[model samples]
Target: MTETKKTTEKTLRRFTLSWQLALGMASGFFVIFIIFAFVLSQILKQYYGRLPETLYQWLGITILLGGLFVFGFAFMLTRYILRPVKSIKTTIEAFEDDPMTNVRADRANVNDEFYDLVNILNRMIDRLQSLIGAQQQFVSDVSHELRTPVTIVKGHMDLLNRWGKDEPEVLEDSIKSSLAEMQRMETLINEMLNLTRAEQIPIENVQEVTEVGGLVHRVFDNFKLIHPDFIFTLDDDLTQDANVKVRQDHMEQILIILADNAVKYSLDRKEIHFALSQTTNRVEIGIQDFGEGLSSEDAARVFDRFYRVDKARSRAKGGNGLGLSIAQRLVKAYGGEITLESALGSGSVFTIRLPLQRENKNDQKLSN
Candidate 1:
C-alpha cells in the first residue's frame, strides 16, 4: 500500500512539457505587465500631481487586452510545440491496441529533431514486423520438423500396445525405430539451442584473442586421425603466428564443423584440404573438399537452419542441418565472415575470414 501510494504521488507530481512551457511564457508576460504598469505610474506622477480617472480606465482596458493576448499566444505556442508529440503518442497507442496493424509515426515536412524521431520510429516498426514474421515462420518450421518423429514414435507405441508386444520381430523393430526417432528429436533440439546461443555471444568472449594457426593445426590433426582412409593435406602459408579477436574454443568448433562437413559430403574422392593463410589485416582459413558439391541455388541457402541439399541423405547421415547455421552465426558475431564456393559434381570450399587482433604496443612496453 505504501509503495502504491508513493508511485501514485510521483505520477501526479510529474509535469508535462506543454504545461511547463505555457506556465513559463505566462509568467514572463505577467512580469513584463507589472514592470510596464509601475513605469507608467511613475511617469504620470512625474508629469502631473495625480493620474486621471479616464487614464486609469484606459490603462485597465489595455491591461485586460494584453493579458488576454498573452494567454492566447501562450496556448497556441504550446499546442504547436506538442503537436508532433501528440501524433507520436496516438500512433503508439494504435499500434499497442492492434500490434499486427502496421502503423507508423508521420514524418514532418521540415528536417528537424522530430523528423529524425519519426524515421527512427518507422525503422523500429519495420524491424518489429520482420521479427514477428520470422518468429512465426520459425515456430511453424519447428513444429513441422518435430511432428514426423513424434507421430512415428506414437504410432509405434500404439502398435506395441495392441499386438506388437507379443511378436519378437515387431517389438524389436518398433523399439529400434522409436529410439531412433527419439534420438533425432534430441539432436534437433540441441542444435536449435546451439543456434540460439550462437546468436548471442558473451561480451567477455568478444574480447578473447585466439591464435588461429594452432587451432587450425589441431583440427587438421584430429580430422586426420578420425579419417585415416581419407587423404588430408594442410597448407600453412602463415609465416608469423596470427591471432584474431575470437574465443579459441569457438574457432576450433568452426574448424571442426567445416572439416566434418567435408568428410560427410565426400562421395567418391576422399580428399580434404586445410589451408591457413594471412593477409595484412585478416586471417583466412579455407576447408576444401572434393565432395558431391552443391548447385548454385543450394549453395546460396546452405547456411539457413534446417536446409539441406538432400534431406533424405542428410537424415541418413544424422545431420540436423544446423551446423552451418551455427557456424555462420558464430563467425558473424566476432565481425568475421564465412563464404562458400561450390559447383555441382566439382568441389566445395568453405572459407572463413577473421580480423587479426592487433598487438597493443603500450601494453607490451608496460610488460617489458
Candidate 2:
C-alpha cells in the first residue's frame, strides 16, 4: 500500500501546472454553467410563461460552442505543458538507436523538476560518451602496442624452431631477440596496470600537504645519481611556505616519470633542468630537457598511452611509451594538470601545475 501511494504521488508529480490549471478551470466552469442555466430557465418560465423553440435552439447552439471552446483551450494548454517531456522522450529514443548523435537535449522552458532532470540526464550522457570513447581508444592502443612485440617474439621463435636451433649463431640471436621482446611486453603491462590504478585512486589516498621544493630536490638527487653522465639542475624559486595539495609519494612518482622522459629524449645535449615556481593559486613544476624535441603534432598526442615519438628509438631506449600518460592520470587524480610544450629540435618542457593548498603551519612543522 505504501508503495502504491508512492507510485501514485510520482505519477501526479509528472503533471505540470498547466494540467492542474486546465482541470480546475474545466470543473469550475461546469458548476457555474449548470447553476446559471437552471436559474435562467426558471426565471424565463415564471415571467414570460413558455419559452420559444428558437430560444431553446439558440441556447443549445451556445452550449455546444462553449463546450468546444473549453475543450480546445484545455487541450492546447496541456499539450504546451507536455512539450518538454515529449522532446526528452524523443531524444532518448533517438540516442538509444544511435548514441553518436549530439548528447545534449533540446527543450524549452520545462517545469522546474523536469528541467533539472533533463540537465542531469544530458550530463550523464556526456560522461558516458567520454568513457566509451576512452575505453575504445585504450583497447586499440593496447592491442597495437602488444601486437608488434608479440609478432617479433613469435617470428624469432619460429625461426629457432625451423633451423636456428642447430645453428649456434642463429640460436643466440633468436634467444636474445625473444627475451628483449618479452621484457618489453612485461614493462608495457606493468605500466598499463599503473594507469588503471591511477584512474581509480581515491582522493583520500592523496589527501596530504606535500612540500613541493623538497620533493623536487629529492627527485633531482636521485636522478643525478642514476644518470651521472647527464647534467641535472634544480631551480627553486618558490618560498619555503610553498605547499601543494598532493601526497608526497604521488608527487615523487610524477616527478620521476617526467624526469625519466626528459632523460630518454636528451638527444645530444645531456642536460635536464627541474624548476619550481608558484602563483597565488597554483604551484608549477617544470622539467625541461635539451632533447630531440617533438613536433606540434607529436606533442599533442605525447600523453596518449602507448604513443611514442619514435618507435624504433623508444624501443632501443627500453621505453614502452606509457610514462607520460600514467603521470598525467596520477597528477589529475590529485587535482593537478600536466602539460607539455615543445617544438621540433628546440627542446621540450613538461610542466605540472598543482593547486596550492592554504598555508598551513602544520605542514611546515611536518617538513621540519
lDDT of 2 by residue, 1-368 (tens): 99699667656665555567777776677667667777888899999999999988887787767766776687677777677776786678667867766846664678886888888878777766666665666677679788988999989989999989689999999999899888888888888778776775667656678888888888899999989999998888987566877778778889999999899888888999999899989999999999889888999999987788888898898888888988999989888898899988879999999888885799779989
lDDT of each: 0.85, 0.82
**Best of the candidates, lDDT:** 1
- Give the per-residue lDDT of model 1 (tens digit) for 194-221: 7766776753546778999988998899
Error of 2 at 306 (Å): 4.5
Measured against the true structure, the TM-scores of the candidates, in listed sequence, are 0.78, 0.70
Candidate 1 — which residues are off by over 4 angstroms? Answer: 1-28, 39-48, 53-58, 80-84, 98-134, 200-205, 359-368
Assess the local accuracy of residue 270 in candidate 2 as a C-alpha lDDT between 0 and 100: 98
Candidate 2 root-mean-square deviation in Å: 8.4
> Model 1 misses residue 334 by how many Å?
3.2
Candidate with maximal TM-score: 1
